[model samples]
Target: MIIIIAGIGRIGYTLAKSLCDKGHDIVLIDSDKEICNKVSAEIDALIIHGDCTKTKTLEEAGIEDADIYIAVTGKEEVNLMSSLLAKSYGVDKTIARISEIEYKDVFERLGVDVVVSPELIAANYIEKLIDRPGILDLTIIGRGEAEILEFIIPEKSKVAYKKIKDLGRPQDYLIIAIYEGSELKIPSGDIELKPGDRVLVLVKKDAVDIIRKMFLE
Candidate 1:
């Protein structure tokens, strides 16, 4: 998928890296030319130094061909304009990050496909979304008290060959399911986790380090 990201802020950059690592074609836009140059050498993506809210800049970023356009700048107004411009160019999906919670309805009413609020979501660039390789995805819930995580079991994981019930997991975290190849299996007590399998877990945020020590270390 061809994804164009505007802003290059913390969430924007992290999202770009995550998508790029997943083998997607990515084009990044930022007004700061220095950061553009710095990011070019670090990630496998096209870096465009320009204001994403402008028509010429969006055109230069090839917005029409973008499968998804995301605006995650600190300024909600810029994000709004950039995503609207991308939608006008016929981009199928558009996502915007906004700090102001009240504007979410307005953004959606104005044709933005998805509106994300940093305060409401556990994905507030909070934790390991791109902080580690095997940890595929993460979401914080209960106001940072708990987290939902999707992690691929590493080959060197301590409990890879162990049964779900045999691991002596703490009460705070639960192994929700195991994904093997294309199939999803409920984590039965007898189900032995495999190295290549992906596991979805819900854990207390404070106890995540223990979960990592077992599955990601």
Candidate 2:
């Protein structure tokens, strides 16, 4: 995947490095030349020093062939405009980061594929951590309609030691993956979930409490 990340701040830099480590082609754009220079030396990605909202910079960053364009600048206006511009340039997907809680709807209405608010996400994450100690990680996706939760299967979990098939089909949630020690395995009908195994579950927001109780309580 060819990904263009606008902004070289903490989030953009981290995203670029992680994506590059995953063997994806990443291009970074930023208005700060010094940050770009510093980031260029640290991350294995193409760095363009320019405004992401500008077509000239987008062209320089090869927006025409970009599979994904992510605008995560500190400025919400820049992020929104850059994403809109990327969409116009034929990028397959556009993700914009906004700090304002109220502009999510407007940004989506303007055609951004994903609108992320760092503050909102952080608050949710912290809330989950306090409310659900069993959860190790929580990623809200599908526009907040669903979440992917990572947790360890407790010894007393109702679903532990049971084959996935026996856990009941046509369920409200899906156990996608299990990590046993150092090995990662995809969930299947006959695979029995063992206690202490790390599990990744994809479930709707409404089903979170139900699954948490079954596994954590």
Candidate 3:
């Protein structure tokens, strides 16, 4: 994929590195010359120093042929303008990093392909640490209507000694994977649940409270 990224801050730099490592064609643009020089020296992608919201600068970054354009600058207006400009230049997809809590609906209504809020993402991650410390991580999908969660089995869990299929998990929920130490295994009907195992389960969002009461309580 040909990806054009605007901004060279921590999030942008890390994203560029990870995507480049996956073998994507990347073009990184930032107005700061020093940061551009540093990032260009470290990554194999093309790095340009320019205002991302400007058409000429975006042209220099090859936005006309880009498959994806991402704006991660700290300023919400700049990010939005960059993404909108990329879209105008025929980029197939555009994503913008947003900071304001109230502008999300407006961004979606304006047809931004994706909007990521660092604050919201960080808050959600922290919530996992406090609400379900036993879970490694959790993802809410379909507008928070469903979720996939990772949980470690405690010694006293009621299902610890039961067979996987005999745990009485609701029909709408499913245990997808099990991690025993470093090994990850797919759960099967006959597989026996054990203490010290980590499990990933998919469930409806509304059913989470019920599931937690039955298993974690």
Candidate 4:
């Protein structure tokens, strides 16, 4: 896939690197020449030193043929304008990172494909980390109707010594995998949950409380 990334800041640079590593064609644009050069040197992608909101710059970056266009500048206005321009130029999909909460509704109303608020995402992540210290990460899918949670087995967990199938797990929730130390293994019915094990589980939104009671609490 060809991805055009606007703003070669920390988030943009990281995203470009990850996509480039996956063998995607990435075009990075930034107003700061130093940042553009620095990131270009680190990754195998085309880097252009120009403002994303400018039509000429975007045209030079081949926005017309872009599969995905992402605007992640710190300024919300710039990100929004750049995304709109990308869409107008025939980019297949446009994603923009916004800082102001009020603009989210506007973005949705404008038919923006995706709008991400780093602050909100970070706050939620931090809150989850604080509330569930054993949880390594959490991803909401099915439009937030379902969640995938990664948790480390605590020594005091009730199910720590029990077999996978004996935990009385609800049908809506499924244990997907278990990581014992450095080894990742699919959890089998006979496999016993042990302390220090990292477990990945998929649960429906309605079953979240059950998951909390069973694993978190």
The candidate that achieves the highest lDDT relative to the unseen native structure: 2
Per-residue lDDT tens digits for candidate 2, residues 37-144, read: 998899989999998988999999999999999999999999999999999988889999999889999999999999988888898789987887789998888677
Off by over 4 Å in 1: 122-186, 189-217
* Residue lDDT tens for model 1, 47-89: 9999898999999999889999999888999999989999999
Error of 2 at 168 (Å): 9.3
lDDT of each: 0.87, 0.90, 0.86, 0.87
Estimated TM-score for each candidate:
0.62, 0.74, 0.92, 0.88
C-alpha RMSD by candidate, in order: 8.8, 3.6, 1.7, 2.1
Instruction: Provide the lowest-lDDT 10-residue window in model 2.
Output: 164-173
| TM-score: model 3 vs. ground truth | 0.92
User: Which candidate, 2 or 3, would have the higher TM-score against the true structure?
Assistant: 3
Model 4, 22: alpha-carbon shift in Å? 1.3
RMSD of 4: 2.1
Positional deviation of residue 213's Cα in model 2 after best superposition, in angstroms? 3.9
Candidates, ranked, TM-score? 3, 4, 2, 1
For residue 103, what is the lDDT in candidate 3?
Answer: 82
